[model samples]
Target: MTDPLGQQRPIDIKAQLQACRSKEDTFKTLVMLSKTQPRLTAEEKTEDNKIKGCESAVWLIIEEKDGLRHFKADSDAKLMRGVLVAILSLVKGKSLADIQQMDLKAELAELNLSSYLTSSRTNGVLAILDKITSH
Candidate 1:
């Protein structure tokens, strides 16, 4: 990704999440980020894009550019949108190999965010990762 200076840089997603002083702050930050994510069009919201395990109707759209994946995700549920953004933050603009190497569960655990999620939501998150890696 490019900075405001137009210089190449890696977005430290983990560090951004870690900067949140509390869970509430983290959640708010995520929600804000979610609003910034590109919305998936109706044509892109087919059953194929919908995550099967999610309680919420979450849709993920991925495009490859120069070997890096760009993700655009959305959900019917508001909190789920925030969760989607958090997950997307990790993998966005990363190569498939980088995303495949990620330990998403461990990262969430380290961030103390996993404990706040319901089992179904966790499953949904894993499902998203599974879809990404399978691509």
Candidate 2:
């Protein structure tokens, strides 16, 4: 997918995240992609351990095994769960510097999520961000 600015781009983090609009859309895409990729187990979904801060009871687990970062996450809210999956897809295997360098605010604007998110839902998204950056 190309951006509105008319640029053909590589598979960078920003472009990948800009592909979705609402959190639900993000989730749906992630779920569909995961079908062809790999399914995350319950045990693997515990990274960064910020599950307690999530409004919808989300669990995220990330690990740096070998040279790649791995993530597995789940949430009671289907949409939020999908959002987490989308986030994992972008940052899961990246280094800390790469994850930190991502323009999360710009990506969120591209996704057009601010108008669609509740305060709690926004908080939940922040929790996910914290998890990614913390690792």
TM-score, one value per model: 0.80, 0.64
- Model 2: pairs clashing at backbone N, Cα or C within 3 Å: 27-82, 46-60, 46-61, 47-60, 47-61, 47-62
Best by TM-score: 1
lDDT for model 1, please. Answer: 0.74
lDDT score at residue 9, model 2, on the 0-100 scale = 27
Clashes of 2: 6
Clash number by candidate, in order: 0, 6
Candidate 2 per-residue lDDT, tens place, 2-120, comes to: 33543222254345556767667655554544343344466655544546556787777677877667676666566565455455656656788887999765566565445545788
Q: Model 1 reaches what TM-score against the true structure?
A: 0.80
Cα TM-score of candidate 2: 0.64
Worst 10 residues of 1 by lDDT: 5-14
Candidate 1, 1-135: lDDT as tens digits: 545744223345455667888878778766765575567889989998899998889998889999999877889877778677667666778899988898866766655465457889888888998888779
Model 2 CA deviation exceeding 4 Å by range: 1-50
